[model samples]
Target: MGTLFRRKSRMVVVDFLPLPPVESKRLNKAISETGFCSRREADRFIEAGQVRVNGAVAGLGVKVTPDDKIEVNGEMISKEVPKIYLAFHKPVGITCTTDTSKKDNIIDYINFPERIFPIGRLDKPSEGLIFMTNDGDIVNKILRAGNNHEKEYIVNVNRKITQAFIRQMSNGVPILDTVTKKCRVERINDFTFRIILTQGLNRQIRRMCKHLGYEVTRLKRMRIMNISLGKLKPGQYRHFSPKELQEINQLLANSIKTEEASEN
Candidate 1:
């Protein structure tokens, strides 16, 4: 009996020994790990008193362990949520913004079951293929202008075919306080042309056409990097195929992902 009692005592003492510290990360990071939102959005929730850790309001920069419960706006955030990636065919007039207050916002239009944001934006007046994902890390890597990812567009201008116009566009055009980079521009028809650009400036194709004395009648993006619209009609969306996802991951393997510093 004494031997058994001693063994129990030893077990109790072992249990009392200090445990290795539980890994903890910033509150915003913990929330973002669930794929619920980006770190910036998480910080906003913290500042707005919409985030709670273990039933207490969370503060900015607070560290949380994996075992801690995290809730946003009274909804418990689960880290097991699946990451979503989509290629959407944006229709003209749909704004590429997350603000629900704004009419015709892309988020409202898609009504995705899981919260997601566009990787980059397409102009409201122009439309075509755009990427949407819940993985915030991938968004930065894909959107970074320096990454040199290709975005292809088919543009219709109000003019007759001119060899000089194609030559000038392919060479480069001055716009947005800087000369645009040389890109591949090919004439498709009398007034239609295809352009693949590595840099995304504000309304780049439109501005380039206007600079050359042409007005864009229609602008539609056809592809982004390796993904093409591929029969997805306007306002339609499709999940990224496994092969596409694999290729994209391979492409971004060496790409850099960055986050803006938030004051909150």
Candidate 2:
């Protein structure tokens, strides 16, 4: 009886020693940050028996520590490096997509070291400057629906443009279920015009001209925000200079500050 009691006491004392705390976040956060899915969707994947930890099926509420192995859909997930930003003068007929299946996708046209995506879209049929970046955060800042970043385009119409049409365009023509925002329009020649817009509504220029009973013969974007196409010819690209980058960063900072102030 004494020996049994001593052994039991020893066991109890050993059990009282501290154990490591379980990590709070697990597979869900990893999967979500990898852009595989949202947190809620990750949880569903766990519950559905689609996730694995160390090659074993994982269930919801599974605790994942730093050393634990994790996989989703039979693929391993690893941390990615910081994203890169780039600028390219997209020529006509090149689709602004990464998909290789498309005959003339942007990826095939520009041979860059990193995988980048356009901040916003430039239609395949149109030609001009386009911003490309892998940094998703900047994409939101530049392309947010409410952002008023000026985009300038040189447009050539099929027919002679009259002063009345220019007045109507500047005065705000109705299109896309809303009155077009006030914009800057200048007649450069008999059929050529320079337009600066604060809002991007799909093929806005094309739609606007169509509404005014004019056909756009050629359209080319010359500027976005503070960056200009400059002397860049079609199908050319270059890195932003330090000053250019600083300017863009400043613009984004100011825009964010303005938005926050308005909410308050």
Candidate 3:
């Protein structure tokens, strides 16, 4: 009997000896990764006392283990929630913002049953393929400058295409205080050309055209890495196939994955 009690006492002591620093995640990122909301929005909700870690209210930047019970507005968040990845054909005049306060926000426009955000912006005036996903973890890996993911676009300028223009655009053009990366530019015909870029800057193509005295009459993204726009029409969205997702995972295998620490 004494031996069993001593063993029980030792077990209790061991349990209290501070758990091997549980592999934890910040409350907001975990929430966002579960298709609940964006991390920024999660932060806002946490500050407003709508989020809880374990049974207690959560504070900003609180670290939580996977086993911790988390809730928002009295509803428990499910870690097993399905992840959604989509190819959305953004039409001109629709915004890529996640902000619900704006009428043009993509989230509101799509009205997906669950919350989601566009992976990156497709400026309101520009149209074409853009990715939207409920998984916040992959957003940075795909968008970060270091990854070098390719995005192809077909562009139409106001003036006729010139060989000099092709050469300048392909080699590099100074924009946004830095020279644009050398990208593949192929002349499709006069006034239209195709460009595949590994880097994205604010209104990059438009700015590149303006630098050379050209006005962009039309600009539409055709592809993003392994995914293509295909025949998806304006304001339409389709889920990624398992094979496509598999290939995408393979493509990003060497690219960076956003871990919990850096995300906070």
Clashes of each: 0, 0, 0
Better-scoring candidate (lDDT), 1 or 2: 1
Better candidate number, 2 or 3, judged by TM-score? 3
lDDT of 3 by residue, 31-94 (tens): 9879887676788999999998887998997988889899999999888779999999988888
Worst lDDT run of 10 residues, candidate 1, spans 255-264
* TM-score of each predicted structure versus truth: 0.83, 0.71, 0.84
**Runs in model 3 lying further than 4 Å from the true structure:** 1-23, 40-50, 55-57, 72-76, 257-264
Q: How do the residues 21-85 of candidate 2 rate in per-residue lDDT, one tens digit apiece?
A: 86656677655545444455578888888899889999877767666777888987553535455
User: Once superposed on the true structure, which residue ranges of model 2 sit more than 4 Å away at CA?
Assistant: 1-82, 254-264
Question: For candidate 2, what is the lDDT?
Answer: 0.75
Tens digits of lDDT, candidate 1, 70-104: 99999998867788889999999999888899999
Between prediction 1 and prediction 3, which has the larger TM-score? 3
Model 1 TM-score on a 0 to 1 scale: 0.83
